[model samples]
Target: MLFSETELQRVSVVIKGILTPYVAEKIDKNHYRVRTEIKRPGKYLADVFDSDNLIGKINLHVLSETQKKSGGDDFDSMF
Candidate 1:
């Protein structure tokens, strides 16, 4: 089979033109972010979980008596 290089370039230009800048920017950022996770992996459910303990029994307490969280889980979710 034979193909024309000019036709390929035209299709490429059309595809690039239709993609919005915001969408394109997000895709670019996501591509690079994948690398960081591999370098220094953080907590993952699979890593913490095992056959014997899916959820730690210690976390099942009904109430929290801690001073920081007085009534019902008032835990600070600060980022």
Candidate 2:
């Protein structure tokens, strides 16, 4: 699908807002690495800093409508 530059920028802003508290690094074209403390459910505080420990990553690739419905694995078999 085609998206205008303005539309893409809006999407980026939304992503940044949702990823707050944890620092996000754009490691690639669309991948991001997020790190935080190691705490279980209900143990996380709103203003706690745990040394910015390593946590996990997130991918924010744009997908076509068909890809969204089809699980976006059309090329998985090639590997």
Candidate 3:
């Protein structure tokens, strides 16, 4: 795997502190997919990197009450 279990756990904690939760799903022997939801208002952001180089990011917004209220069970289901 490109990332170790320890690395995934570390990232998960960081994501949770930003007001979202993430579960790391191993995509293959060398890749992973992070699943999460932005459950609050305003912009939500997270960044992934390899050393100093940026690898990925999530920048999302829940600007409407309906959007904030919808489709958030996935976070609870992850546990």
TM-score pick, better of 2 and 3: 3
Instruction: Please give the TM-score that candidate 2 achieves against the real structure.
Output: 0.26
TM-score of each: 0.12, 0.26, 0.31
Model 1 lDDT tens row, 1-79? 1122222211111111223111111223112111111222232221111223222111111222353264445355532
Best by TM-score: 3
Alpha carbon lDDT of each predicted model: 0.21, 0.36, 0.51
Distance from true location, Cα of 49 in model 3, Å: 11
Q: Model 1 compared with the native: what TM-score?
A: 0.12
Per-prediction RMSD in angstroms?
A: 21.7, 12.7, 9.7
Tens-place lDDT digits, model 3, residues 10-58: 3331242565445456665556665556556776566665444455665
> Which segments of model 2 are wrong by more than 4 Å?
1-20, 41-79
Residue pairs clashing in model 2 are: none
In each prediction, how many residue pairs overlap at the backbone (N, C-alpha, C within less than 3 A)?
0, 0, 0
Off by over 4 Å in 3: 1-13, 16-20, 39-44, 47-79
